[model samples]
Target: MEHLKTFLLKRFRIKDLGDLKYFLGIEFSRSKKGIFMSQRKYALDILQDSGLLGACLDNFPMEQNLKLTPTDGALLHDPTKYRRLVGRLIYLTVTRPDIAYSVRTLSEFMHQPRKPHWDTALRILKYVKGTPGQGLLFPASNNLALKAFCDSDWGGCRATRRSVTGYCVFLGNALISWKSKKQTNVSRSSAEAEYRAMANTCLELTWLRYILQDLKVLQTVPVPLFCDNQAALYIAANPVFHERTKHIEIDCHIVREKLQAGMISPSYVPTRFQLADVFTKALGKDQFVTLRDKLGLHDIHSPT
Candidate 1:
């Protein structure tokens, strides 16, 4: 580290910051157990800017089974505020995967936000207020094996009827990457949706493996990819193709190819233990809390 610093110092004038305490809007704190990250100040600033600092707090970001259509309610008089707030919330999701689904849903309405959509967006703020210091924790561990969970909500979007794909990848116990997104094409069945999600997860895993290889982190064993759908697992393992899966032939090929190459091993995980469920849809408080803990999110400000 000193050799590189000396080389850079000789050519360009630079000052050592010593260690990364904060960058952009993220706050970092370290201990023997692990490094903790949060956006507490950023979150509080957002609440103050939106006049939600004193609003009633919410235990969870969104209601379970809540559906928001494009034409649900009257359009907002000034959508600029809605757009800006949702945009900031989108950035906040970088360290707060707990709110990913809510923010993703709100982002869809940015083009034509309705009153109800604005209200739902504010509800997210209220939830943020409850734990502004909540963030990801990278625990100190020697294990670096990659594990992943992927899920799909078949036809989750009420307006477009598009399935939502959600997946989270962990290096050891630390969450490295996650996403909640709507599929571009409509799926004919739940298995197809799950298969598409597996394909997307496979792509992410493949990229991460390359990154690890560059960092000299050798992966001797194939990474485990957990999915709740048995049919999807069977599809990945099965070599024969059928008419039912013809539409998603490309997606099947992507996952099956990786499986055949021993890059990723697809397995079944029960819905209750599926941590990716929180990203796919709005969950109840109990289930949300359960999965949120499993995601390695910690509130540093909370009493021990």
Candidate 2:
């Protein structure tokens, strides 16, 4: 990586190693095309543990635009099963970004899972059962461009009236990080929620830049952060203080600072192409597949 050379020139000395085969349960393979990482063995073990190794494959991870509420189901007599599945799903999200939101939704009910929560958790397991070989594909490229996508669903959590936020970071076309979670406080408007999500995304971007720098990979250009909300982009580009925008947090201002310093820039993207949408809520089969492909996830065994 040219970036790595650029970064390493200033930092600690380093040595080149040969191709990587495995690390931390994730296996890697390299060819002229690119490097591939997957947790096939781990996925299979999880399915076998849950007794769904031979189950039929699911067409989608979750129901189309599925919504889960805090009070929608009866309390479970035992929560041990639900908790175990949730824990595994969390780790799986490291490679299966498609199920991040659903896993986050299920984890919320860990304290006192209900029937519906348990059912949803099982649905996720069933989905995982079918795709043990699916993983991220990092095609060989000349550049490791950094970019981010962020999205939020206003008042998505029915119980708290708090919005759900999600974002994904990509190095070149390969996904490196992502998240799906709820906002701490209720946002008065959709723009406010979008702003908060952008701020979170900004923090992630900042940290990632540092990591790459530490690894001797330096980004040559400003990271473009994509969002579906125009208001959020406007707020990031402007620097006016108003009472109505007082709730706008200090963290949110970091976006402007990054922009001004040529570290990061905010850009608008259509909701249809917003990759982070997958992390904010469930979607229909067609849309989900589209975003998943965009994120560079494909079945390694599939004939290309």
Candidate 3:
């Protein structure tokens, strides 16, 4: 531990507060309820610095039915500044999944951020202002059932028309792993898009299973992956190659093989219970809050 601290000190300005009460952007508080993570202070500083503290905070980060396209406008006259802002926001994802999907969306345009993109980012800053203390809580629990939720937005990206795949892995009620990523390949149909997303989610689940085995927490029960697409779930259960599925890469078949071997099971879940929905699409304010809370996230500034 001493050597690790020396390495960090030498690389950056050293301000050893003795113990790590906070690191990066997350505020750490330990109690009988287990470790509660929040970023209230960091979120407030970002809002004030971005001059969005006084702006009206919208319940959601982006407006409904909003679309983004490549613009020929001058890409953020100062590219470095835009990059810096993105860097900070990405770090905040450690404790702020509320901004995860939005941050990942803005990151795609980092190569060439236009005025509209910057305005959208500022809007997110304002939204953060309204709920600066919101963060995830890892309550103490022994029932570590490895359940997961996965979903995808069919051709959500306007530029490449590629789909966005998202999944969140939970240990009991605490969200342990989550991702919001754009698929590398484009799908011709919604089912195809969902299949690809499931493949990716399966791969993550497989890795987590192996990781748990290494940690000596291996369970006999198969991991359950809750997906909203019934078609995709059925495809995984059977190996028959349909006309549409044949076009998919051979590597994607790994998911189907894993399912047949009983490593994981893909079950259909209703859209209302899909917690991964927050990572795949921009939702209404109420919907976002509901899913966020389900992920075990709460506002630390609020009285429990």
Candidate 4:
């Protein structure tokens, strides 16, 4: 970059900003082990705006086994406020992926937020308040392997009866991408939901491989994708689809094609080791913290 800057300066004028410290509401810093990224100021502002800056903290964003129904809560007086606040929190998820599941849950009621829904959103803000400085850490290393975990909650949404798909991709030990989204179509079975989530993850892995290729980084090994559902693994590895799986025919084929092509290797993981579960559903505080830590996120100021 320095050499290119010199050559470009000879032809035209440009300014140098040195190394990046902060940009687009995200703070950046370096440590002996790795690079740290956080949205501390942005998160604090959200708490302050919601009058939760001094509020007691919540160890987890949402309650364990928490369920929300559109018809359950009292109608909010101002729907616009709920929309705006949820929008801001969505942006914060760029660095705070730990809150992705909760934000996705809250965003569902944007059209007509109820008092209960707004209360749940406030709970997320409180969770953010407790760990504003916690964020991703990308360590400097030679491990460039691309691996991922894919999981889903079968019909977690009551009103829509739609499954939630979640996956996280890791380049070595650093998390590069993750998503928690409601499937457009309703799945008839848990295996079907898991199969669809695996298909989504396979496509994402393929795209990331192409991006790495564009940067001249070659991935020689087949990407390994871990799924907790044994039935889903069997479906991916099997080419034969039966009566029950007819509902998920397309997804089954997509995953099978990827597996046959050696683009991705599907493996079984136990529920306790499934990192993507945190993204797929509301979790207890103990479980949330364990997986969040596994994502390589920690407070930058905390003692090692």
**Which is the leading candidate under lDDT?**
1
Instruction: In candidate 1, list every pair of residues with a backbone clash.
Output: none
> Scored by CA lDDT, what does every candidate get?
0.94, 0.85, 0.82, 0.90
What lDDT score goes with residue 68 in model 4? 92
How displaced is residue 138 in candidate 3, in Å? Answer: 1.1
Q: What's model 1's lDDT at 304? A: 97
lDDT, candidate 3, 1-304, per-residue tens: 8999899999999787874578766788877787788888887887777777788877888765466666745567887777778777888888888778888988988888887778778878877877888888788665877888889989999889999999999887888899999999888887778888788878888888889889988857878988888888777877788676788757358787777788887899999999999998888878888888788888768776
Error of 4 at 302 (Å): 2.8
Candidate 4, 8-30: lDDT as tens digits: 88998777788789999999998
lDDT at residue 54 of model 2 (Cα atoms): 69
lDDT of 2 by residue, 1-304 (tens): 8787779867877765656787777878787888888887888888888888767777777887667776777988878977887898788887788889999988888888888788777777777776777888888874788999999999987788899999999988889999999999899999999999998998899899999999999998899999999988888887886776788858567777888889888899999999999998888889988998898887776567
| Decoy 3 TM-score against native | 0.89
Candidate 2 ranges with C-alpha deviation above 4 Å = 1-19
Model 2 poorest ten-residue lDDT run: 13-22
- Model 2 clashing residue pairs (backbone): 4-216
List clash counts for every candidate, in order.
Answer: 0, 1, 0, 0
Best by TM-score: 1
Give, for candidate 4, the lowest lDDT window spanning 10 residues. 295-304
Model 3 worst lDDT run, 10 consecutive residues: 65-74
What TM-score, computed on C-alpha atoms, does each candidate reach? Answer: 0.99, 0.89, 0.89, 0.97
Residue ranges of candidate 1 with Cα displaced over 4 Å: none
Superior by TM-score: candidate 1 or candidate 4? 1
